[model samples]
Target: MNYGPLLFLGVFLTLASSWCGLVLIPQLQLWKSGGLEAVKLEKTGEFYPPMRSGLAEHGREVYRANGCIYCHSQQVRPKGFGGDFLRNWGQRRSVGRDYLRDKPVMLGTMRTGPDLTNISLRQPSASWHMLHLYNPQITSPGSIMPPFRFLFETRKIRRMRSPDALDLKPPFAPPPGYEVVPKPEAQLLVDYLLSLRAVTPLPETE
Candidate 1:
């Protein structure tokens, strides 16, 4: 009595069921719930999760290119699931609809840095983001996040300082006659970072 055929059948069923439960069923449920559709905000009557566009959209490419997703996660853990709520990472847990606009959603795998689902709301200043990108330690002392100095250029000031130049003091500052200005990619990356606001309240997650 060979049990090989029975074993193979059992394994196949197990894998198929796992795939259906993990992927297929969730996708069908998301579609049924209209996760792709933008819902109206109850407060302002405006649309929630607006589409990504312009330089900010392009900046997402830069972020992906730089592997920023490796160190950061965009999804906030639900209450009692983790300390995300206690840490003030987000106002509420992230839902499927919050990421409707992302073409390939960047719900990162690791959390080397803090969650960035609501970075724009937490740190709204563009200059601060620029400085932080150039050197994270400037804004966040003792931070392990690496600086993206390659995305900026240090050049001698002509007659006047570029308005976009990062303001630095002492150790992190360029030479006396030089100023560090962000390149197009850096600006675009900052724009994308600034666009990451997931504070909207949804009925499903509530």
Candidate 2:
């Protein structure tokens, strides 16, 4: 006759336990030791530094706004997990520490495009990134990424082209009388992409 009160108590206990296990436990673990464990350096004593440049951070926002995550995954799964290792997306599997400071990690869900975790190392030239962004086909002959031309401008060629103007060749050229110069946003985005690299050798991830 009084089973309703007992049932309510049991439900409350179950919910409390679930919340403690799911939320509290993870928070405690991640924040324990002042979170120093999450940011410890690798065996080589090298640590991946945070984004120091404002342009790079702004570029990250631009990347998110552009929905680059929909087509790309920054993660590199270990050998048994997927082809990420085989494809050389990264030198080693990504670790939690690699993204500890990411705030909102960019480890996307799909691999429509290659992982950009180490793109700065993969192609170190800013010009290449600019060309690719202006029109993917310019750098990658068959890349399906659409050109972000609005991020650039075509202005009449003055006596001297803007120092930041792209060095376009034949087919990728804008026009004889005009030159392609990346606007500030494009420059920042390129800088950000160029800054993405994993230098440390984290064996635990492998």
Provide the overall lDDT of each model, using Cα atoms, as 2-decimal numbers.
0.92, 0.81
Candidate with maximal lDDT: 1
lDDT of 2 by residue, 1-206 (tens): 47998999999999999899998987787677344344446554544545448888888888888888999888777766877767777777776667765746889988777989889988999999998999998888988888999999999988987888888898888888889999988988998899887656654554
TM-scores for every candidate against the unseen true structure = 0.91, 0.82
For residue 201, model 1's alpha carbon misses the true position, in angstroms, by 1.3
lDDT of 1 at 140: 96
Residue 190, model 2: Cα distance from true site in angstroms: 1.3
- In candidate 1, stretches whose alpha carbon ends up further than 4 angstroms from where it belongs are 1-12
Q: Model 2 segments beyond 4 Å from truth? A: 1-20, 33-47
